[model samples]
Target: MFIVFLKFSENKSLASQFMDGHNQWIKQGFDEEVFLLAGSLQPNLGGSIIAHNTTLVELQNRVNEDPFVKESVVTAEVFEISPKKADARLNFLVGA
Candidate 1:
């Protein structure tokens, strides 16, 4: 699994743009069973997303295409996540 941490920079305001594009991603089919979970950190500092079984290349590509990235509203860091035991309460697992 991969976890993407996005830290918004000063290029542009991220919240509204990000939310619009995020919702569009969900509507588009990226939300089917791959993303796992996504949301922003409180205070709108940045955002984080958990994606299952995806490569770094794929994650980068997705981020590149995201409106926030495309519009230069935020910068991101992608990390490989090793969850010893995923919590079902958070619905981080697909189809949970």
Candidate 2:
């Protein structure tokens, strides 16, 4: 599994301009079953995504394609996680 943080950058103002494309990128992730969750960061700092079913290099390439990242509206940091255990409902994550 992986956690992707998209923190606002100096060019955060450009966010609105690329929001449509960014949203589309997010939609694509879900459509492909790569993203398990996505939401806003606390205090509006930025956004985050919990993802799986992909390798780190592939995830990095995917993140690079986000309009927010490509246009410098945000900086993306991807953290990989080795899941050893999970709640029963989320046991699928253990193999990620």
Candidate 3:
């Protein structure tokens, strides 16, 4: 899985300017079952997303297409995690 942070840039205004397109990009990820969860960060700074079904390199390429990244509204920082354990209901997250 991956924990992705969208850190706001100095050109924060671009976020609202391109909000629609950014949302579309996010929808695409969910539609493809790559993103499992997402939400805004504290104090409205930016946002975060939990994703799977892809590799870091592939995720980077996908994030690059986000309007937020394209218009300099935010910079994407991705951290990959290899799950070793999970609750019974989510056991599928960590496979043998």
Candidate 4:
């Protein structure tokens, strides 16, 4: 699994301009079953995504394609997680 953070950048003001494309990219991630969750950061920091079923390289490439990232509206950082345990409902993540 992975946690992807998209923190606002100096060009944050441009966010509105690319939001539509960014949203479409996010929808595609879910449609492909790679993103398990996506939401805003507190205090309007930016956004985040919990993703799986992909390699770090692939994920990085995907993130790079985000309009927010491409247009410098946000900076993307991806963290890989090796789950040792999880609640029953999330057990798949542990084994994955």
Query: What lDDT score goes with residue 21 in model 4?
Result: 100
Question: What's the candidate order when arranged by decreasing lDDT?
Answer: 4, 2, 3, 1
Residue 62 C-alpha lDDT in model 2: 99
TM per prediction? 0.72, 0.98, 0.94, 0.99
1 or 2: which has the higher lDDT?
2
Candidate that would win on TM-score: 4
Arranged by TM-score, best first: 4, 2, 3, 1
lDDT of 3 by residue, 1-96 (tens): 899999999999767789999999999999999999999998988999999999889999999999999999998899988889899987767852
Per-residue error for 85 in candidate 4, Å, reads 0.5
Task: Kindly give the number of clashing pairs for every candidate.
Answer: 0, 0, 0, 0
**lDDT tens string, model 2, 1-96?**
999999999998889999999999999999999999999999989999999999999999999999999999999999999999889999999976
Among the numbered candidates, top lDDT falls to 4
Query: For residues 57-90, what per-residue lDDT tens digits would candidate 4 score against the true structure?
Result: 9999999999999999999999999999899999
Model 3, stretches more than 4 Å misplaced?
A: none
Model 3 weakest lDDT span, ten residues long: 87-96
Q: What lDDT does each candidate get?
A: 0.70, 0.96, 0.91, 0.98
Task: Spell out the clash pairs found in candidate 4.
Answer: none
Instruction: Report how far off residue 3 is in candidate 3 (Å).
Output: 0.7
Residue ranges of candidate 1 with Cα displaced over 4 Å: 14-18, 26-30, 84-96
> Candidate 1 residues 1-96, lDDT tens each?
778877787965555846787668645525456677778877867777777656678778877777777777778888876666656775454432
